[model samples]
Target: MRACTFVRASKEVVDVADVAALVKADLERARDTNVTFSRHAMRVVPVETTCFAGVDEIKEACKPLIEKHFKSGREQTFAIAFERRSNNTLHRTEVIEAIAGMIEQPPNKVNLGDPDLTIMVEIVKGVACLSVVQDYEKLCKYNLRMVAMTKEDREHAKATANGNAPAPGTKKNDEEKPAEAAD
Candidate 1:
């Protein structure tokens, strides 16, 4: 957990969405400025609440948060992202199932690829951090290095988008080499 720093922003900030919005704005600004000031900060994930690291605790913690975000008759796509470090008591599928079961089925659905809201469950040691976040995937999973793209990176991205060049390590797309005859 050397690289990970958990901060209770809700104490100062109004809501979890505020923390996420602040992060998004900072990342957007960094990208716009093309600054690589973030060296070791790989990813900065903001959780809404934290509870004792247990399935029951996690369920209890998520209940109100789930209700707040996934209201009845409100159509929304959601996905559960569970990451555990130095903890083995909690099962991945079990946690996902419990959280998914809490949400309204018809009105809300699970979309792994693109979800309107993401229930982030992070179990570190004896604490289970939970958060309902928007744009979870679009922000490169909240990766600073990925979001704050440099000029060369932007150009490579543009070139790759136009099919004018292969991405970093990829070979030429139009080139073909004849198979060597087996000795």
Candidate 2:
């Protein structure tokens, strides 16, 4: 499975395993401590993008998908966010207008603040990763991923997965729950 790891460290220092560890730890700790956690920052979700040469290209590729995925035929809020990376000629407003015209209307009008549906267009090297989101979440600052667990740390990870409490001197303050293990 192709996976995208999301975290707050440089690409040089992080990988999928690190993100997975964070996910496992977050879930386990949340389970034990009765704390709430959102997959928003710690899980992988589908992100769709379409490649195009310019603004017109984006419209052709993204319009139909936007229509099908937009689904908010009024009674809902929606908005579009645009980003250009590859020395494009068109303006941001033009991109917004191109895509917005396809989805915006009536009660489901443009609501930039807390929109029920957020369409994001991120263009890098002429490739656009445009996606529709009901719940908007972002990667860590500067899109940094997670830091990894060292080899010496592997034993502790195995112990936790086996439903054992963390090795002494290895647990975080919030994960120091003496009441339960693998809750």
Candidate 3:
């Protein structure tokens, strides 16, 4: 589908956010150059690996991801965000709980409100696309338009691409901008 396409990059691309950032930059550049079709993308979801939609397959796929992101014994909060389309064989709770059970706790905790890392599980048909991503919630869950809509979101997205933090007070929505007085 044009709206969503699965992209598999070489090992140099670390996470979904990285692909999203690359797409965002390319889109931004296209838009700046007045490329009309640059506005076509609405969301950009990235995945590190794919597996058949089964508990065992998912567990096997998640091993390396869990090791890379959580095995260092760092205190990081995470959440499992699940999305399914044209697939209902796997229960959401079951999949989430299964993945959650695999990660070691105490050093790592689950924070639904705001997680430092997000394990994105997208089940399209019978295939499962998985990725451990940072700033999932912050980037509007990888929505291209939302991330590129405002100057602030753009700045934050850019910082995220460069592995930096957004400047303080840049998270405000467009509606929250100060109104201009009538001339």
lDDT agreement with native, every candidate: 0.80, 0.56, 0.77
Clashes of 1: 0
Highest TM-score against the true fold, candidate: 1
Tens-digit lDDT track of model 2 for 25-81? 554454344443643343332345457647888898887666666664647777776
Q: Which ten residues in a row have the lowest lDDT in candidate 2?
A: 138-147
**Candidate 3 residue lDDT tens string, 112-142:** 8889989999988889999887777766676
Worst 10 residues of 3 by lDDT: 29-38
Clashing residue pairs, candidate 3? none
lDDT of 3: 0.77
Model 1 segments more than 4 A misplaced:
10-12, 15-17, 31-37, 150-173, 176-183
Clash tally, candidates in order: 0, 0, 0
Question: Distance from true position, residue 26, model 1, in Å?
Answer: 2.6
Q: Model 3 Cα RMSD, Å?
A: 9.6
Ranking by lDDT: 1, 3, 2
- Regions of candidate 2 where Cα sits further than 4 Å from its true position: 1-46, 72-74, 137-183
Model 1 lDDT tens row, 1-183: 666875554454564346656767777776677664567787777777789988888899998898778886779999998999999888999999988988888888889999999889988988898888888777667667767787578567658778887567667756787689999
